[model samples]
Target: MNQVWLRVAQLEDADAIAQLVNRAFQVERFFIEGDRINPGAVRELLRKGKFLLAEQSGALAGCVYLEPHGDRCYLGLLSVDPGRQRSGLGTLLMGAAEEDCRAAGARGIDLQIVSLRTELPGYYRRLGYEENGTAPFPASAQPKQPCYFIRMSKELG
Candidate 1:
Protein backbone atom coordinates (compact mmCIF):
# COMPACT_ATOMS: atom_id res chain seq x y z
CA MET A 1 0.00 0.00 0.00
CA ASN A 2 1.16 3.55 -0.67
CA GLN A 3 1.90 5.84 2.25
CA VAL A 4 -1.04 7.81 3.61
CA TRP A 5 -0.39 11.52 4.14
CA LEU A 6 -2.02 13.88 6.61
CA ARG A 7 -2.82 17.57 6.25
CA VAL A 8 -4.96 20.32 7.71
CA ALA A 9 -8.01 20.96 5.60
CA GLN A 10 -8.97 24.26 4.03
CA LEU A 11 -12.41 25.66 3.16
CA GLU A 12 -11.97 24.30 -0.33
CA ASP A 13 -11.97 20.80 1.11
CA ALA A 14 -15.46 21.08 2.54
CA ASP A 15 -17.22 19.45 -0.35
CA ALA A 16 -14.84 16.54 -0.59
CA ILE A 17 -14.92 16.13 3.17
CA ALA A 18 -18.70 16.14 3.20
CA GLN A 19 -18.86 13.54 0.49
CA LEU A 20 -16.34 11.35 2.26
CA VAL A 21 -18.22 11.63 5.54
CA ASN A 22 -21.56 10.84 3.97
CA ARG A 23 -20.15 7.84 2.17
CA ALA A 24 -18.40 6.53 5.23
CA PHE A 25 -21.55 6.92 7.29
CA GLN A 26 -23.92 5.20 4.93
CA VAL A 27 -24.10 2.48 7.54
CA GLU A 28 -26.14 4.94 9.56
CA ARG A 29 -28.97 4.06 7.21
CA PHE A 30 -29.86 1.55 9.90
CA PHE A 31 -30.40 4.37 12.43
CA ILE A 32 -30.36 7.95 11.21
CA GLU A 33 -32.04 10.24 8.78
CA GLY A 34 -30.23 11.87 5.88
CA ASP A 35 -26.49 12.01 5.24
CA ARG A 36 -23.76 12.43 7.82
CA ILE A 37 -22.82 15.90 6.53
CA ASN A 38 -23.28 18.43 3.76
CA PRO A 39 -20.80 20.89 2.33
CA GLY A 40 -22.56 23.85 3.95
CA ALA A 41 -22.49 22.16 7.33
CA VAL A 42 -18.84 21.23 6.88
CA ARG A 43 -18.09 24.85 6.00
CA GLU A 44 -19.79 25.98 9.19
CA LEU A 45 -17.82 23.44 11.22
CA LEU A 46 -14.60 24.59 9.55
CA ARG A 47 -15.20 28.02 11.01
CA LYS A 48 -15.03 26.63 14.54
CA GLY A 49 -12.67 23.67 14.19
CA LYS A 50 -10.02 22.13 12.01
CA PHE A 51 -10.26 19.00 9.86
CA LEU A 52 -7.39 16.59 9.45
CA LEU A 53 -7.40 14.69 6.21
CA ALA A 54 -5.71 11.44 5.30
CA GLU A 55 -4.77 10.95 1.71
CA GLN A 56 -3.33 8.02 -0.26
CA SER A 57 -1.69 8.72 -3.56
CA GLY A 58 -3.17 12.24 -3.51
CA ALA A 59 -6.72 10.91 -3.11
CA LEU A 60 -8.79 11.59 -0.02
CA ALA A 61 -8.94 8.47 2.15
CA GLY A 62 -10.36 9.63 5.46
CA CYS A 63 -10.78 12.58 7.87
CA VAL A 64 -11.68 13.68 11.37
CA TYR A 65 -12.79 17.02 12.78
CA LEU A 66 -11.32 18.53 15.93
CA GLU A 67 -12.77 21.39 17.92
CA PRO A 68 -11.06 22.85 20.95
CA HIS A 69 -13.02 23.85 24.02
CA GLY A 70 -11.34 24.79 27.25
CA ASP A 71 -9.19 21.86 28.41
CA ARG A 72 -10.61 19.37 25.96
CA CYS A 73 -11.06 18.95 22.27
CA TYR A 74 -14.20 17.58 20.61
CA LEU A 75 -13.52 14.98 17.94
CA GLY A 76 -16.17 14.01 15.46
CA LEU A 77 -17.17 12.85 12.01
CA LEU A 78 -14.34 10.35 11.86
CA SER A 79 -14.64 9.01 8.33
CA VAL A 80 -12.72 6.38 6.44
CA ASP A 81 -13.37 5.54 2.86
CA PRO A 82 -15.33 2.31 2.65
CA GLY A 83 -12.59 0.86 0.51
CA ARG A 84 -10.01 1.74 3.11
CA GLN A 85 -11.86 0.59 6.19
CA ARG A 86 -9.91 -1.69 8.54
CA SER A 87 -6.64 -0.79 6.87
CA GLY A 88 -5.53 1.20 9.95
CA LEU A 89 -6.28 4.55 8.37
CA GLY A 90 -8.91 5.41 10.99
CA THR A 91 -6.44 4.63 13.74
CA LEU A 92 -3.81 6.85 12.15
CA LEU A 93 -6.24 9.73 11.79
CA MET A 94 -7.20 9.38 15.45
CA GLY A 95 -3.60 9.42 16.66
CA ALA A 96 -2.90 12.50 14.60
CA ALA A 97 -5.99 14.24 15.99
CA GLU A 98 -4.92 13.52 19.55
CA GLU A 99 -1.44 14.84 18.89
CA ASP A 100 -2.85 18.01 17.39
CA CYS A 101 -5.19 18.48 20.33
CA ARG A 102 -2.43 17.97 22.85
CA ALA A 103 -0.20 20.45 21.04
CA ALA A 104 -3.06 22.94 21.25
CA GLY A 105 -3.01 22.59 25.07
CA ALA A 106 -5.95 20.25 25.43
CA ARG A 107 -5.69 17.74 28.25
CA GLY A 108 -8.33 15.39 26.93
CA ILE A 109 -10.54 14.58 23.95
CA ASP A 110 -14.28 13.87 23.78
CA LEU A 111 -16.63 12.40 21.25
CA GLN A 112 -20.25 11.27 21.00
CA ILE A 113 -21.39 8.18 19.21
CA VAL A 114 -25.00 7.45 18.43
CA SER A 115 -26.37 5.03 20.98
CA LEU A 116 -27.89 2.77 18.40
CA ARG A 117 -24.52 2.03 16.97
CA THR A 118 -23.84 -0.76 19.43
CA GLU A 119 -20.44 -1.58 18.04
CA LEU A 120 -18.98 1.89 18.45
CA PRO A 121 -18.64 2.15 22.21
CA GLY A 122 -16.53 -0.98 22.33
CA TYR A 123 -14.47 0.20 19.41
CA TYR A 124 -13.77 3.50 21.12
CA ARG A 125 -13.05 1.76 24.40
CA ARG A 126 -10.32 -0.20 22.70
CA LEU A 127 -8.93 3.12 21.52
CA GLY A 128 -8.72 4.32 25.17
CA TYR A 129 -11.93 6.32 25.35
CA GLU A 130 -14.17 5.72 28.32
CA GLU A 131 -17.90 6.04 28.41
CA ASN A 132 -18.54 9.28 30.27
CA GLY A 133 -22.31 9.64 29.95
CA THR A 134 -25.12 10.12 27.51
CA ALA A 135 -26.73 13.19 26.03
CA PRO A 136 -29.77 13.79 23.91
CA PHE A 137 -29.04 13.51 20.24
CA PRO A 138 -28.46 16.82 18.56
CA ALA A 139 -31.59 18.23 17.01
CA SER A 140 -29.79 18.56 13.74
CA ALA A 141 -29.10 14.85 13.76
CA GLN A 142 -32.65 13.99 12.68
CA PRO A 143 -32.58 10.56 14.16
CA LYS A 144 -34.99 8.03 12.73
CA GLN A 145 -36.07 7.03 16.22
CA PRO A 146 -35.48 8.06 19.82
CA CYS A 147 -31.73 8.17 20.11
CA TYR A 148 -29.05 9.54 22.37
CA PHE A 149 -25.37 10.20 22.12
CA ILE A 150 -22.98 8.13 24.17
CA ARG A 151 -20.38 10.60 25.31
CA MET A 152 -16.86 9.19 25.50
CA SER A 153 -13.56 10.73 26.47
CA LYS A 154 -9.87 9.97 26.72
CA GLU A 155 -7.27 11.81 28.75
CA LEU A 156 -4.05 12.84 27.08
CA GLY A 157 -0.82 11.94 28.77
Candidate 2:
Protein backbone atom coordinates (compact mmCIF):
# COMPACT_ATOMS: atom_id res chain seq x y z
CA MET A 1 0.00 0.00 0.00
CA ASN A 2 1.06 3.57 -0.57
CA GLN A 3 0.65 6.55 1.72
CA VAL A 4 -2.90 7.01 3.02
CA TRP A 5 -4.76 10.02 4.35
CA LEU A 6 -7.64 10.38 6.76
CA ARG A 7 -10.52 12.78 6.23
CA VAL A 8 -14.04 13.40 7.37
CA ALA A 9 -16.46 11.16 5.49
CA GLN A 10 -18.71 13.13 3.24
CA LEU A 11 -22.25 12.32 2.15
CA GLU A 12 -20.99 11.79 -1.37
CA ASP A 13 -18.99 8.78 -0.27
CA ALA A 14 -22.04 7.06 1.22
CA ASP A 15 -22.80 4.91 -1.80
CA ALA A 16 -19.21 3.83 -2.15
CA ILE A 17 -18.97 3.22 1.58
CA ALA A 18 -22.24 1.31 1.54
CA GLN A 19 -21.05 -0.94 -1.23
CA LEU A 20 -17.85 -1.53 0.69
CA VAL A 21 -19.64 -2.29 3.95
CA ASN A 22 -22.28 -4.57 2.51
CA ARG A 23 -19.87 -6.36 0.18
CA ALA A 24 -17.37 -6.93 2.96
CA PHE A 25 -19.67 -8.51 5.55
CA GLN A 26 -22.99 -9.34 3.93
CA VAL A 27 -21.96 -12.88 3.06
CA GLU A 28 -21.87 -14.08 6.62
CA ARG A 29 -24.98 -16.13 7.35
CA PHE A 30 -24.59 -15.59 11.03
CA PHE A 31 -26.08 -12.16 10.67
CA ILE A 32 -28.54 -10.63 8.26
CA GLU A 33 -27.06 -7.38 7.11
CA GLY A 34 -28.81 -4.11 7.74
CA ASP A 35 -29.86 -1.84 4.95
CA ARG A 36 -26.91 0.31 4.01
CA ILE A 37 -27.38 3.46 6.01
CA ASN A 38 -28.76 6.38 4.09
CA PRO A 39 -26.37 8.96 2.70
CA GLY A 40 -28.23 11.48 4.78
CA ALA A 41 -27.19 9.61 7.89
CA VAL A 42 -23.59 9.71 6.84
CA ARG A 43 -23.97 13.42 6.28
CA GLU A 44 -25.41 13.77 9.76
CA LEU A 45 -22.48 11.87 11.18
CA LEU A 46 -20.18 14.24 9.38
CA ARG A 47 -22.15 17.15 10.73
CA LYS A 48 -21.86 15.77 14.24
CA GLY A 49 -18.20 15.10 13.54
CA LYS A 50 -18.34 11.35 14.16
CA PHE A 51 -17.10 9.78 10.96
CA LEU A 52 -13.73 9.40 9.27
CA LEU A 53 -12.59 8.06 5.94
CA ALA A 54 -9.30 6.62 4.76
CA GLU A 55 -8.02 7.30 1.29
CA GLN A 56 -5.01 6.79 -0.89
CA SER A 57 -4.39 9.09 -3.81
CA GLY A 58 -7.97 10.36 -3.60
CA ALA A 59 -9.57 6.89 -3.62
CA LEU A 60 -11.91 5.93 -0.84
CA ALA A 61 -10.25 3.04 0.99
CA GLY A 62 -11.86 2.53 4.39
CA CYS A 63 -13.84 4.18 7.19
CA VAL A 64 -14.96 4.04 10.82
CA TYR A 65 -17.66 5.90 12.76
CA LEU A 66 -16.98 7.04 16.27
CA GLU A 67 -19.79 7.99 18.66
CA PRO A 68 -18.42 9.92 21.58
CA HIS A 69 -19.90 9.32 25.03
CA GLY A 70 -18.14 11.09 27.82
CA ASP A 71 -14.78 9.35 28.28
CA ARG A 72 -15.55 6.42 26.01
CA CYS A 73 -16.19 6.32 22.31
CA TYR A 74 -18.31 3.77 20.54
CA LEU A 75 -16.93 2.56 17.26
CA GLY A 76 -19.38 1.27 14.73
CA LEU A 77 -19.85 0.43 11.07
CA LEU A 78 -16.17 -0.07 10.34
CA SER A 79 -15.31 -1.29 6.89
CA VAL A 80 -12.66 -1.39 4.21
CA ASP A 81 -13.26 -1.86 0.54
CA PRO A 82 -12.78 -5.48 -0.44
CA GLY A 83 -10.57 -4.45 -3.31
CA ARG A 84 -8.29 -2.74 -0.82
CA GLN A 85 -8.26 -5.34 1.94
CA ARG A 86 -5.15 -7.10 3.27
CA SER A 87 -3.23 -3.88 2.71
CA GLY A 88 -3.42 -2.39 6.21
CA LEU A 89 -6.36 -0.15 5.39
CA GLY A 90 -8.31 -1.48 8.33
CA THR A 91 -5.49 -0.63 10.68
CA LEU A 92 -5.29 2.82 9.21
CA LEU A 93 -9.00 3.36 9.79
CA MET A 94 -8.81 2.08 13.35
CA GLY A 95 -5.81 4.25 14.10
CA ALA A 96 -7.60 7.29 12.76
CA ALA A 97 -10.72 6.49 14.77
CA GLU A 98 -8.70 6.18 17.94
CA GLU A 99 -7.02 9.47 17.26
CA ASP A 100 -10.39 11.08 16.72
CA CYS A 101 -11.62 9.74 20.02
CA ARG A 102 -8.51 10.90 21.85
CA ALA A 103 -8.78 14.31 20.30
CA ALA A 104 -12.30 14.45 21.75
CA GLY A 105 -10.90 13.57 25.18
CA ALA A 106 -11.93 9.96 25.16
CA ARG A 107 -10.34 7.69 27.73
CA GLY A 108 -11.00 4.58 25.67
CA ILE A 109 -12.47 3.48 22.38
CA ASP A 110 -14.65 0.39 22.03
CA LEU A 111 -16.38 -1.72 19.43
CA GLN A 112 -18.63 -4.72 19.26
CA ILE A 113 -17.50 -7.49 16.97
CA VAL A 114 -19.66 -10.44 16.05
CA SER A 115 -18.28 -13.08 18.32
CA LEU A 116 -18.70 -15.81 15.74
CA ARG A 117 -16.07 -14.38 13.47
CA THR A 118 -13.35 -16.49 14.98
CA GLU A 119 -10.53 -14.65 13.32
CA LEU A 120 -11.87 -11.15 13.81
CA PRO A 121 -11.28 -11.01 17.54
CA GLY A 122 -7.69 -12.06 17.11
CA TYR A 123 -7.22 -9.39 14.51
CA TYR A 124 -8.36 -6.67 16.93
CA ARG A 125 -6.33 -8.22 19.75
CA ARG A 126 -3.25 -7.88 17.63
CA LEU A 127 -4.01 -4.19 17.41
CA GLY A 128 -3.91 -3.92 21.23
CA TYR A 129 -7.69 -4.24 21.70
CA GLU A 130 -8.88 -6.49 24.49
CA GLU A 131 -12.09 -8.38 25.00
CA ASN A 132 -13.99 -6.43 27.61
CA GLY A 133 -17.01 -8.75 27.77
CA THR A 134 -19.79 -10.33 25.81
CA ALA A 135 -22.94 -8.55 24.70
CA PRO A 136 -26.03 -9.53 22.81
CA PHE A 137 -26.62 -8.51 19.27
CA PRO A 138 -30.30 -7.87 19.87
CA ALA A 139 -32.02 -9.19 16.82
CA SER A 140 -34.17 -6.10 16.84
CA ALA A 141 -31.43 -3.53 17.31
CA GLN A 142 -29.03 -5.57 15.25
CA PRO A 143 -30.05 -6.63 11.78
CA LYS A 144 -31.84 -9.88 12.45
CA GLN A 145 -28.54 -11.49 13.44
CA PRO A 146 -28.06 -14.79 15.15
CA CYS A 147 -24.54 -14.05 16.22
CA TYR A 148 -23.44 -13.11 19.74
CA PHE A 149 -21.30 -10.04 20.28
CA ILE A 150 -18.14 -9.31 22.20
CA ARG A 151 -17.20 -5.89 23.39
CA MET A 152 -13.60 -4.93 22.81
CA SER A 153 -11.71 -1.92 24.02
CA LYS A 154 -8.39 -0.19 23.45
CA GLU A 155 -7.18 2.32 25.99
CA LEU A 156 -6.16 5.66 24.59
CA GLY A 157 -2.66 6.03 25.92
Candidate 3:
Protein backbone atom coordinates (compact mmCIF):
# COMPACT_ATOMS: atom_id res chain seq x y z
CA MET A 1 0.00 0.00 0.00
CA ASN A 2 1.16 3.51 -0.68
CA GLN A 3 1.73 6.01 2.09
CA VAL A 4 -1.72 7.32 3.03
CA TRP A 5 -2.32 10.76 4.50
CA LEU A 6 -5.37 12.79 5.46
CA ARG A 7 -6.02 16.44 4.73
CA VAL A 8 -8.78 19.00 4.46
CA ALA A 9 -10.14 19.12 0.90
CA GLN A 10 -9.87 22.28 -1.10
CA LEU A 11 -12.36 23.62 -3.65
CA GLU A 12 -10.17 22.21 -6.42
CA ASP A 13 -10.75 18.69 -5.17
CA ALA A 14 -14.50 18.71 -5.91
CA ASP A 15 -14.26 16.71 -9.13
CA ALA A 16 -11.97 14.00 -7.78
CA ILE A 17 -13.96 13.77 -4.58
CA ALA A 18 -17.22 13.38 -6.49
CA GLN A 19 -15.74 10.65 -8.66
CA LEU A 20 -14.40 8.77 -5.68
CA VAL A 21 -17.68 9.03 -3.76
CA ASN A 22 -19.80 8.01 -6.72
CA ARG A 23 -17.60 5.03 -7.39
CA ALA A 24 -17.63 3.86 -3.80
CA PHE A 25 -21.39 4.28 -3.52
CA GLN A 26 -22.12 2.45 -6.77
CA VAL A 27 -23.53 -0.24 -4.51
CA GLU A 28 -26.59 1.98 -4.27
CA ARG A 29 -27.58 0.76 -7.74
CA PHE A 30 -30.93 -0.33 -6.30
CA PHE A 31 -31.86 3.29 -5.82
CA ILE A 32 -33.81 5.38 -8.31
CA GLU A 33 -30.64 7.24 -9.13
CA GLY A 34 -27.67 5.22 -10.29
CA ASP A 35 -24.95 7.60 -9.19
CA ARG A 36 -24.52 8.38 -5.52
CA ILE A 37 -23.16 11.90 -6.00
CA ASN A 38 -22.14 14.52 -8.51
CA PRO A 39 -19.56 17.25 -8.53
CA GLY A 40 -22.28 19.86 -8.23
CA ALA A 41 -23.59 18.24 -5.09
CA VAL A 42 -20.08 17.97 -3.72
CA ARG A 43 -19.49 21.62 -4.45
CA GLU A 44 -22.66 22.47 -2.60
CA LEU A 45 -21.53 20.45 0.39
CA LEU A 46 -18.19 22.27 0.39
CA ARG A 47 -20.06 25.50 0.99
CA LYS A 48 -21.56 24.14 4.21
CA GLY A 49 -18.74 22.12 5.77
CA LYS A 50 -15.29 20.62 5.45
CA PHE A 51 -14.32 17.41 3.70
CA LEU A 52 -11.50 15.22 4.92
CA LEU A 53 -9.68 13.39 2.15
CA ALA A 54 -7.37 10.42 2.33
CA GLU A 55 -4.81 10.08 -0.41
CA GLN A 56 -2.50 7.25 -1.30
CA SER A 57 0.47 7.96 -3.49
CA GLY A 58 -1.14 11.20 -4.56
CA ALA A 59 -4.35 9.47 -5.56
CA LEU A 60 -7.62 10.24 -3.84
CA ALA A 61 -8.50 7.15 -1.84
CA GLY A 62 -11.32 8.12 0.49
CA CYS A 63 -13.21 11.04 2.02
CA VAL A 64 -15.86 12.07 4.54
CA TYR A 65 -17.77 15.30 5.04
CA LEU A 66 -18.03 16.94 8.44
CA GLU A 67 -20.50 19.63 9.44
CA PRO A 68 -20.42 20.98 12.97
CA HIS A 69 -23.72 21.74 14.65
CA GLY A 70 -23.53 23.10 18.17
CA ASP A 71 -22.28 20.26 20.38
CA ARG A 72 -22.28 17.67 17.63
CA CYS A 73 -20.69 17.23 14.26
CA TYR A 74 -22.58 15.58 11.43
CA LEU A 75 -20.44 13.14 9.46
CA GLY A 76 -21.63 12.02 6.06
CA LEU A 77 -20.79 11.12 2.48
CA LEU A 78 -18.08 8.76 3.65
CA SER A 79 -16.55 7.00 0.67
CA VAL A 80 -13.57 4.77 0.06
CA ASP A 81 -12.27 3.99 -3.38
CA PRO A 82 -13.85 0.85 -4.73
CA GLY A 83 -10.44 -0.70 -5.30
CA ARG A 84 -9.44 0.13 -1.74
CA GLN A 85 -12.45 -1.27 0.13
CA ARG A 86 -11.89 -3.81 2.91
CA SER A 87 -8.36 -2.55 3.42
CA GLY A 88 -9.25 -0.78 6.73
CA LEU A 89 -9.24 2.63 5.07
CA GLY A 90 -12.86 3.23 6.03
CA THR A 91 -12.11 2.55 9.66
CA LEU A 92 -9.18 4.91 9.55
CA LEU A 93 -11.33 7.64 8.01
CA MET A 94 -13.98 7.11 10.68
CA GLY A 95 -11.43 7.41 13.45
CA ALA A 96 -9.95 10.51 11.87
CA ALA A 97 -13.38 12.10 11.52
CA GLU A 98 -14.22 11.45 15.15
CA GLU A 99 -10.89 12.88 16.30
CA ASP A 100 -11.43 15.92 14.11
CA CYS A 101 -14.85 16.47 15.64
CA ARG A 102 -13.45 16.07 19.13
CA ALA A 103 -10.66 18.51 18.39
CA ALA A 104 -13.29 20.98 17.23
CA GLY A 105 -14.91 20.77 20.68
CA ALA A 106 -17.84 18.62 19.64
CA ARG A 107 -19.29 16.46 22.35
CA GLY A 108 -20.53 13.89 19.87
CA ILE A 109 -20.55 12.85 16.25
CA ASP A 110 -23.70 12.08 14.31
CA LEU A 111 -24.36 10.32 11.04
CA GLN A 112 -27.17 8.86 9.00
CA ILE A 113 -27.07 5.65 7.04
CA VAL A 114 -29.64 4.53 4.54
CA SER A 115 -32.00 2.12 6.24
CA LEU A 116 -31.97 -0.11 3.18
CA ARG A 117 -28.28 -0.79 3.70
CA THR A 118 -28.94 -3.32 6.44
CA GLU A 119 -25.27 -4.01 6.96
CA LEU A 120 -24.36 -0.43 7.84
CA PRO A 121 -26.06 -0.06 11.22
CA GLY A 122 -24.11 -2.99 12.60
CA TYR A 123 -20.89 -1.66 11.13
CA TYR A 124 -21.33 1.68 12.84
CA ARG A 125 -22.46 -0.04 16.01
CA ARG A 126 -19.18 -1.89 16.11
CA LEU A 127 -17.44 1.47 15.95
CA GLY A 128 -19.32 2.63 19.08
CA TYR A 129 -22.11 4.47 17.33
CA GLU A 130 -25.64 3.73 18.45
CA GLU A 131 -28.82 4.20 16.55
CA ASN A 132 -30.78 7.03 18.13
CA GLY A 133 -33.72 7.22 15.74
CA THR A 134 -34.81 7.28 12.14
CA ALA A 135 -35.41 10.27 9.94
CA PRO A 136 -37.24 10.51 6.64
CA PHE A 137 -34.91 10.07 3.73
CA PRO A 138 -34.13 13.22 1.83
CA ALA A 139 -36.63 13.99 -0.92
CA SER A 140 -33.75 14.59 -3.23
CA ALA A 141 -32.70 11.02 -2.80
CA GLN A 142 -35.74 9.75 -4.77
CA PRO A 143 -35.33 6.27 -3.43
CA LYS A 144 -36.86 3.53 -5.54
CA GLN A 145 -38.25 1.75 -2.51
CA PRO A 146 -39.34 2.84 0.94
CA CYS A 147 -36.29 4.24 2.61
CA TYR A 148 -35.30 6.28 5.65
CA PHE A 149 -32.25 7.40 7.53
CA ILE A 150 -30.88 5.52 10.53
CA ARG A 151 -29.54 8.23 12.76
CA MET A 152 -26.45 7.14 14.69
CA SER A 153 -24.29 8.95 17.20
CA LYS A 154 -21.08 8.41 19.18
CA GLU A 155 -20.13 10.47 22.18
CA LEU A 156 -16.59 11.81 22.40
CA GLY A 157 -14.94 11.58 25.80
Models, CA RMSD each: 1.3, 2.4, 1.3
Task: Give the TM-score of each candidate.
Answer: 0.95, 0.84, 0.94
**Cα lDDT for residue 29, candidate 2:** 43
lDDT of candidate 2 at residue 103, scale 0 to 100: 84
Q: How many residue pairs clash in each candidate?
A: 0, 0, 0
Report the C-alpha lDDT of model 1 over 9-119, residue by residue, as the tens digit.
999999999999999999999878678789999999999999999999889999999999888999999999999898899989999999999999999999999888998
Error of 2 at 153 (Å): 0.7
Model 2 root-mean-square deviation: 2.4
Q: Whole-model lDDT, candidate 2?
A: 0.78
Q: Is candidate 2 or candidate 3 better by lDDT?
A: 3
Span of ten consecutive residues with least summed lDDT in model 3: 28-37
Candidate 2, position 118, lDDT: 84
lDDT of each: 0.93, 0.78, 0.91
lDDT of 2 by residue, 1-157 (tens): 8899888866678777766666666545455656556666676776655668888888777888888777789898887877888998898888888777888889998888876678889899998999989987776756553678899999997
Model 1: how large is the Cα RMSD against the reference?
Answer: 1.3
